[model samples]
Target: MQRKVDPEGLAAAAFLAFLATAGLFYVNIMAAIVDGLVSGLAFTDAQAGQVAAVNTYGAAFGAAVSIFTIARFDWRKTSILCLVILVAIDLLSILSTTPMTMIGIRTLHGLVGGLLIGTGMGVIGRTANPDRSFGMLLFVQFGLGGLGVMFLPRLVPLYGVAPLFLSLALFSLVTLCMMPFLPDYPPRSVAAPIKKAGTVQWTPLVLAISALFLFQAANMGLLAYIFRLGTESGLSRDMTSGALGLATWVALAGPLLVMVLGRRFGRFPLLLAGMLLTLGGNALFHWSQFGEVYLLANCATGITWGLVVPYLFGMTAEFDGTGRTAAAASVISKLGLASGPLVASMMLGGGAGFAELINTALAALVLAMLLMLPPAIMLDRSARRPSELLPQGKVTA
Candidate 1:
């Protein structure tokens, strides 16, 4: 057998993946600041949305490359290169001053983003046993990664845009420093010399990916404009900003709660519960006139996003436990999550209003619920004997 990676070391490696992932999110605040400065060039909300979507677009394309490249490339090498690329992309932003520049840079960033994050998924598959749930592990990554996003709003008041970019640059730098300690996750199987790397069955994986795409699309579509929603509803920026900050702070707890609940109830029910809360929160966004309601919406956002972010990856592994599993997941996210805001932003075809955007998001949410029905039903059939499909290993840390 190829050297079985040490569990302690592997977990440590996974945490570093989280550190880098969180750094990407942390940099998003800078992306937003850059956007504010750059949006003047965008003729329509849709165009501005596309600029935001560039990362997702690049990520999706990059995932396709990962599908082929992961087999031949050293994942370790790819990761380091991508981290360096992230810094280069951020540094290049100083020279950019228009919507096109934003799109191009974000796209490049996403490409590197896809290679780096997808490699982390590939690493997790090779290191862990069949029974190890990716959900909790993925949560740890998202939770840490989310710290950047969670605190992004706060950065605006402290550093302004240029320094905000510099701050994000530092986060990426820290992640890069931590990289060498991570495990090398080559997909090539040990059982056969000249063997093929791990690859997943496509059908169920597609469904699983679709489920995540819809989930993220719904979430991002709404969040892309959430502050605007709050402002329109008469909530002050101070109040709305507090709500956003609190959501990030509390999100770390949501998955832990679900992980505990998952012991008794199935993962599907928690997903349903999360979706419902998200819907309710969106409704409140439409009608809530009070600061407290905005606060509550943040809680709902944090909880649902927290649960869904990691849970989404777990569902992919459930569908297919292969190295390519992460690639499939990344593909779905790129399409649904990346395109979500762009599509949502243009809800009225160049005439979208606040009411229309809310309606679009609500519709997307409804669709997400619908998408879950088929998968949940199928997973239900196997739940009684879930052990048969996933095999067995130590699940919890």
Candidate 2:
């Protein structure tokens, strides 16, 4: 029998997913935060990159830990504790004077942030439709994230970076109030062992996860330097922020498009198209001197990101019914995210132009596209196999 949809459960899951993935949203406004640190605390470009990288490193660790520990605890309580810790940590970040200090604080923050995100993914995995649930989750994230990107530059100039940290803490505090509505654990069937345990395939799972990591790395590599790139292209801080905001708003169409279409088109086709769009966007950034071109590039990349993430998450869930593979995929993806800015910084050294950043990201995207193709073919073939069909006509590779 088809399961009944729980409206309240869906709402709680979407809200928690938004709050849990705060780190992802933080990245959207990170350029402003890095600028504030540079101006207020005398941080170098490399130091700023370190600050961004450390958080993702910590998040990778947290996600790994979640793979082992998430099944042991109640997600509601776990989320609350994580949020409380995040609030305290964000407040303490205000006192960080040196790059090392900031790195330590952000790394610790990422650990808890990763746990929240993993838990949220776990919740989404338990839903009637993981794809639609994740789509809603991203919708909330991008909608609010867009607003933050739009306003953060103005706020940073007027009130400095301290307000940004404080605002995040405040948001966490508000999200804490909604914990009562969320499920403590996934449904029993979702947590049950697979009937054909030892017969489970691993090759496609590894390929998909690897592809996701590369895709995210390429995306973040460029994103981490967006502010610098924009400024170098002769755009003002407000203009850059506005462009990102518009791009973020445009990204909303991605998940909504998926939700409405809902498997009418196969995942690989959409995934390939999104990847190509993102690659083209990266190329545009490399050649374009005008702010409008940059803004259009951001829009394309944002839309692609939105379209790709849910399917990636769904792939992981399909690979492992218990959600461990999804959690592991999160770890890999977070590590890639951590590495992106570090790699970009290394390429930049002391000072590099927007072209260099674009070139580096383009290379990463090309590699990701290549790696993704094999798995896309494998997944599409598996979907078409007669024996691989589930009861509802869903394909399980």
Candidate 3:
């Protein structure tokens, strides 16, 4: 019997996936997170970046661990526990007096968050349309991230970064309330021989994961320093924050376009266009001294960001019906996020300017786009079928 997609189930699942990945929302509002640590906590720029990097590093580790457990664990219970721990960690962050202490606790927070997001990706991969599911994920991230970047900086001076941590705790609390409403998502069952047969798809999976990592690293490396980039270019804090917020809001178009199109037109064309736009956006940062240019650069990049990520995830999900590849891709994504800050911080510390950083990011994006081609081509060719495949645990010959 053919199964129909339940709209209500899709909504529930997308929301749950969002909540699960919400633990890493700090990355979406990277500028504000960096600022909060700097102004509110008095950490140096490099220290702040290091802290952010380690948090994601821990997340990468946790995500790697999740690849093993994603198909075995009860997602609802796991989400509940992770959210609870995340809330506790956020509250504890408020008490952090030193960078070392904050870094340690944040790493722990990242570990738990990574596990949640990895599991979330697994859920997304199981959906009727992984592309739409991932689009929803980006839509929510950009929406709330816009609000956070716009307002969090304003509150920081008045409340001393307390709002930052508190906001995270509040999000967790809200997610906790939404927990009971989530439908049960059991572990994917697979026959052992069928799993073995699926190994032929690993080559494409690896390529897709590589592309995602490079794209994320390139984007995040710039984002982690965008605030600094703006100020150094003589833009006011208010202007920078406003531009970021508005850009994020506008970025919704990217994901919306993805949802509307799905795989109708294929992946590489959109990815290629998006990547070129991203490259141009990064190039525009070379003119960040101009306000209009700064604003335009952010909007361009943010839109492409929203457009590209879902396709990448959807591409990875194509290789394996069991969601394991998607889960592994999540791990790589976190590693890329973790690496970006470290790389940016090093370049800055070694006397490299923002131009150098942006250029490096541009190069990464180009390479990432190139890496995406083979997998995108493979998936596009294979997709000439009645419909997408489900996790039946066996590969057809």
Question: Cα lDDT of all candidates, in order?
Answer: 0.61, 0.73, 0.81
Off by over 4 Å in 2: 1-10, 127-132, 181-187, 191-193, 316-323, 388-397
- Candidate 1: residue pairs that collide: 22-145, 26-148
- Better-scoring candidate (lDDT), 1 or 2: 2
Global CA lDDT computed for model 1: 0.61
Top candidate on TM-score is 2
- By TM-score, the better pick of 2 and 3 is 2
Which residue pairs collide, candidate 2?
A: none
| lDDT against true structure, model 3 | 0.81
**Poorest stretch of ten by lDDT in candidate 3:** 388-397
Candidate 1, 97: how far from true, in Å?
A: 1.7
Query: How many steric clashes between backbone atoms does each model show?
Result: 2, 0, 0
| TM-score of every model versus the real structure | 0.79, 0.88, 0.87
> Which digits, one per residue and each the tens of the lDDT, describe model 3 over residues 286-338?
99999999999999999998888888877887777555566567778889999
Q: What would the per-residue lDDT of candidate 2 be over residues 8-118, giving only the tens digit for each residue? A: 466655765665565455665666666667655778777888888888888888877776666888776787888889899999998788889999999999888888877
Model 2, residue 11: what's the lDDT? Answer: 68
Best by lDDT: 3
